[model samples]
Target: MSDLILLRHRQIPDLNQLDVYRQHGGFEAFQKAVTTMNPYAVTDEVKDSGLRGRGGAGFPTGLKWTFIDTENWPHYVVANADESEPGTFKDREIMEGNPFQFLEGVALAAYAIEAAEAYVYLRGEFWQIADQLDRQISELEAAGLLGDKLFDTDYSLRIYTHLGAGAYICGEETALLESMEGKLGQPRLRPPFPPSYGLYGKPTVVNNVETLTNVPLIITRGADWYNSIGTEKSTGPKIFSLSGRVNKPGNYELPLGTTFRELIFEHGGGIPDGRQVKAIMAAGASSSLIIANDEALDTPMDYESVPNVGAQLGSASIIVIDDSVSIDWVLRKTLHFFSHESCGKCTPCREGTFWMKHIIDRVHQGEAAWSDVELLNEVALQIKGKCLCALGEFAIEAVTSGIQRFEPDFRAKVSESSDEDELLVESEKA
Candidate 1:
């Protein structure tokens, strides 16, 4: 609604092409930053804009840029294009449609960090998108937009595209760096964060695709201009990948603070088949189920407000669930995904997700007692805060939240199983 910063290709034709992108004020920010502004100034502008990471964590983007270790030589930049989150397809669409802008954003970030090279680490499933981006990166280099000595200035940069082995854990910044370094895709220990030691053991700045994509716009327009679009805390427009029971399921770009009612009904055309909206997974499969009450629906979909509704606006991939579906079924599917995607890095995530999947399978099959449900909840709670990465924590979000918020679904499942068991016992006695 706010003039489509990331999805400009939705309005303009051929925006992915280098010439077409350049014609529409692309690379101007990179040019300005390289030719005139200092690297720190570009970072300061982004810091002032109040832009947070769109990659679930919602960490401050500009603040992250400032953390680059100045003492470390040959710093690096990596744009996380690993869009593996279930129900979140915004980054893939961004790469396929408005790629140059994303690349430009990557360039801006590289410049801000004074890095000579950058990598766009995409999921292996995004091969076609990676191919397109590869061509586009070549085009930028050919046009003197990328490569050494950019814009006739001393600043030099080169960006490359690396494909992950379809591992979701690689979406984690340190793991992504590890994967790029040709290691097993699992998360590294913290304290030496990516900013301090990353990518072959040097200081690095790793950003999400959507997060890096905002950098160009922030640099092009002043920080104040970009800051005015969204809420004070969650600035700029976010692309919500509305899916599931919605009548019209696709990406809807709107200001960060827009309410769920507005996105689902106003932009997403509401639920399908005249069914009542039952719940909202505000952050895709990794989200805690937000009960679709008036207060939850009216709640603003920002980093700060969404949590109050028992969910985080993690990736803002709003998966609507109508009354026609059961929350237990949703939980099963989400658990399966997380379990399969788990890299087996930590015992909690690896075994926890695996057992949770099996327990949810029994629950969904109507073969579990109420205690089984409680065990499921206990296992999920056990997984919290014990893993090396967010994957383990994310695995339990739907499990704990669904059991707590949608108790009826699980109760009906266990109740039906109990009734069947009693019938079997009576028949055996007879």
Candidate 2:
């Protein structure tokens, strides 16, 4: 009903400026949290708001804040700003357009968790954005909004920005922690989760950019008000990054329960040249291929409803595939990306992804027999449950789902003849 909260800068001019942002009530929520409400009370309000993480996990944001170890001294908060996933670029836009709001969200979270220091871990490619944020952080500190003894209170806070070496594996929390520590970027074994052991062996709260961007408003508006926007299970507005085949592809912020038809047709302006959509990759390159039909088009694009169509609403990066596209080519592109980005920490993922890439490449090149498709599918299943982190598992999503939802495409790409026939063709070419 109301205009955008995270993207309010679109309606107001000069919002990126600290003075202009202050004119629009910027940093007021952080001030209220630090001055009026206790830390735990702030956490409780977020829990009551029904806000979930927008970093593909969909975990409760407040619940994560509550997990911070109060016993630990000098807690840290890390904002995941590595927008490496294909078809996912909403975070970069927020940082570029409505920056102060996002920084304010980071500050609010620090107050709630009582973190003395916070860091924005950005990708190496975001050098310009990180530099801009550095200047902004300095502005906030100079304004007495980010430095020690804020608002005449004893609580002190500082925010910093760190850049990763453009590694997609660093997008994972533990991997990000490892990278921040100047080590290799790979995921750590769980059990001692980030809340207990993280970022230099101290309790840390690692949240995504969009997830934190919701904090300021949740604190300003009552939980009841935020909860009334979306469905009972999945509340609040969601920023859907629309890409691929649509005429007007970009970010469209809508309620969580909006349908695929609405996102692709109404917001995205439908497929270009009046082409029919054949499949939907609902969460960028990491999502399973959802058959685009009446049922899928009507399916609600919420965390709870997306799984009914065999995929999670991970980050809501919807990629629309037209009927003119082939599923084999899509899987080839996705597999190549995953294999290249894999950290090679685990055998199944490391080996399976390499093997899948070769098989898919051969199939794409029209040099492989039909059996290669079956072998590729089997290899993807083998790598599903046996990865060091999500990189490997995510690598196989398009492969398995592409094969399942569009078997004809895979079958048509490879030769129908036996392996001997393929070998003879290869020999003749040689």
Candidate 3:
């Protein structure tokens, strides 16, 4: 098996150019999907391939498509390009470097789901990316690969790149849809999943950039061939976005069952400055903090195996932290991010994330109580399972894990608070 799939295209220089992408077999999947196969066949092929969402949710991509409401005509496919999660940058690379492949993936998905239109919703900060994608879409239209009577198969579609106004909540599929519709970016309640209903009350399939990128290849290679790459359950190569403290911190694409030790030591060149491994944020800042003991580091990076190490393989974004870094500071950094990105829609996430930041900020400044750490941990728990989206749920994972798994670090900060006058000032801020 190869060490990479999506990252394999790194050698194809001028990757973003339509001509370069075409020369490299970029649009082959779109041609294959529209010309030879039916939509149900495409969905079935994906299901047979065992492809799952590369986004944080990890839902089965084929199953998600099959679940869409057929009663709702003119379905939509929204490619989520809001790569806002800390320690997760794989999608950015795919969109920025191998854009045509991703666009082909979107077109293939549209043909599969019978969607008339698709939208590439990008984070507002990704205007340059949006521009490139827009030009790519135009090129596809000119080439007769997209638009009325696409590939002459009675399928018509257009993909528009919509820019989101810098909100982390927009990374959530439904929230991304809402933002694309020009509303505020806030998650909606979900029993009416995007499949059943989404984007102007139409059946929508909102997939991550990486997830859709896999579609074109799966169609071209056949399901069984694609399914054979990774483990039985996690049947594909995944790009692990490795960052922080490592000698070569970057995206590494490898099979799912690959071990963390291999990812860090062999692929990532181990920790820099020969520092001892202190913690592993297995799935970016949205995961439970795992103390980097040999057992945890040796655990394989897969859906089932990672959780055994007390963390999730979320988005497969592995962030390595060394001895020089403090858990409290890391939690504080995450808290600050969530707090700043909170859409202020729901009470728990809106009030709770900000509350967490205030407490973590106080702790960082050495003006906290031993009890305050426990309070902050409890607050994170309070917000879990109660908010409108995964953002609220995963937002608290790091903070709660840090306080529970590394209490001494959190408690020691409180002890550094010198006088009662300092405590009073801290109390006022809280």
| Stretches of model 3 off by over 4 angstroms after superposition | 1-3, 416-426
Q: How many pairs of residues collide in model 3?
A: 0
- Residue 153 error, candidate 3, Å: 2.2
Model 1: weakest 10-residue lDDT segment is 421-430
Q: What is the lDDT of residue 3 in candidate 3?
A: 37
Cα lDDT of all candidates, in order? 0.90, 0.91, 0.86
Instruction: Kindly list the per-residue Cα lDDT of model 2 for residues 301-395, writing each as its tens digit.
Output: 99999999999899999999999999989988998898888898999988898989888888888777777788899999999887668888899
Reference-based lDDT, residue 101, model 3? 83
Q: Which one wins on TM-score? A: 2
lDDT-based ranking? 2, 1, 3
User: In model 1, what lDDT does residue 32 have?
Assistant: 89
How do all models score by TM-score?
A: 0.96, 0.97, 0.96
Q: Write the per-residue lDDT of candidate 3 for residues 1-430, one digit (tens) a residue.
A: 4434586567768878888878877788888778888899999998899999998878899999899899878799999999988999999889888888889889888888999899999888999999988888999999998989977778899999988878888998878888888898888888798888899988999999999988888888889898888898998989899998999999888888899999999999988887998899988878889989999988989998999978899898888889988889998889898888888988999899999898888788877767667778889998988888877778798887788888888767886445655674658656
lDDT of 2 at 71: 92
The runs of at least 3 residues in candidate 1 whose Cα sits more than 4 Å from the true structure, single-residue gaps closed, are 416-430
User: How large is the C-alpha RMSD of every model relative to the true structure?
Assistant: 2.9, 1.7, 1.9
